[model samples]
Target: MDIPYTSKPRPDTGLYNAKVGIWLFLASEVMLFGALFSSYILLRVGALEENWPHGLLNIPIGTFNTAVLIISSVTVVMAWASLKMKQFGRFKIFQAITVLCALAFLGIKSFEYKDKFTHYEVWKTDGTRMTGHIEGNPMFLTKAKLVAAGKDKIEFLADPHHYSEGKLKIGAQSGEHKHVEIAIGDIKRLSAFVPAHSTYFAIYFTLTALHALHVLGGAIVIGFLFGPGSKMWHTDPDRFTNRVEVAGLFWHFVDLVWIFLFPVLYLL
Candidate 1:
């Protein structure tokens, strides 16, 4: 059966069926992210001041990703505009750039995640805590893992200041990383900057991972429209244009979420 309002706007809403559906979906997404954001605030506000992590995230990298998303947002709009002008070639070119930007954003995010996984924080039995890198650049290193490997000592490069100690000063380079040989017997706890590492990381992963999923999803849909789905442009130009418009809306929302996320997670 033919679907009503697939190409035409509904009189009551002045929006095609797909457009209306996308807006409704975005509304639900807002509530889902809003709840998570609220939880982050509560967790940070309630946590001990000295224990909350800060300056662990790389601000320069985050800012660069932010620019990538912003550029993708502009390209998505241009893609839609190209379709409106019946410039199929331009639409394809713009959409291709948008997809590439999405991929670049994902690639950078994976690098950041890897950095966190390799980085470590250790609590010694003597009540001293230190954070930095292990000599071997291991992923998810823990006390149990060290024991299971029969390793009695690890060569560590400790950062001058723990992440919780202070914010990263502007234009300041990292201080010298002190080398320390830590004995397994003196280790009380060991963890990477993963979800289980602390409450701050838990929320950080939850928020950024969810947003990455959205970016992936949007990229897939837009990719389809830019590829095989473009056949619709020949058979039904209006419907195909509507499809691109719908995908663009979702892309914009994905970009907007990251805009809020960059500063919250990386800067503050």
Candidate 2:
């Protein structure tokens, strides 16, 4: 048998089944994100002042992504409006722009992830620390290679941009480029700016990755509605328009999450 309330409102609720369902789903989404956001606040506030990382993420890149999502939200409205007006061609154009915006956002996110993976921090037993991007693959230290170096340290070059001359101890990137060494016995810790490196990074990757997955999911649904799902417009215009409206609601929620995320994670 065909399902009831697929397009029509129910007598008791005076709302379509899908409409009620979407609202319930979004309520659950709010709670999920709310818990994570609360965790972020607790982590940030409780972090040791001196150890908290700052000015690490690229603000300009993040601001651009924020703008992209904001614009896509506008397009989503335009697409829905076009369908309501029975202007199929305009709806198609607007929806296509929405998909392109989603792709652009994902592309930028990947670049940011790549930068973090390449960045490194090293700690030595002598209480010295270094920060820079690894220039090449970190070579395995054979006993022969160690003997040839005539030193007790593993040798590797830091990315010249963050390399500094003469000075030791943890500091911001600056000064002349040079090869550096950390003795295995003297090595306290060595790692990239990955999740395991610190509490900051651990939450950073987890939260942002989860949000990105939401973006990906929204894009896939919007994509289907834009392409194969458009066929419904020909057979049942009202139902098809309702579908777009439902999808648009989800898209707007995705955009709103990023609006909160950009400032909270990227700024304060």
- TM-score per model over all chains: 0.97, 0.85
Cα lDDT of model 1 by residue, 1-268, tens digit: 9989999999998999999899999999999999999999899889996788888888889999999999999999999999999999999999999999999999999999999999999999999999889998999988999999999999999988876566763226457779999999999999999999999999999999999999999999989998999999999999999999999999999899898888888877
Worst 10 residues of 2 by lDDT: 162-171
lDDT of 2: 0.80
After superposition, the stretches of candidate 1 with alpha carbons farther than 4 Å from their true spots are 169-171
lDDT of each: 0.92, 0.80
Please list all clashing residue pairs in model 1, or write none if there are none. none
Model 1, residue 16: C-alpha shift (Å): 0.7
State the displacement of the C-alpha of residue 265, model 2, in Å, after optimal TM-score superposition: 0.9
Candidate 1's clash total is 0
Candidate 2 lDDT over 204-247, as tens digits, reads 89889988998899899899999999999999898898888899
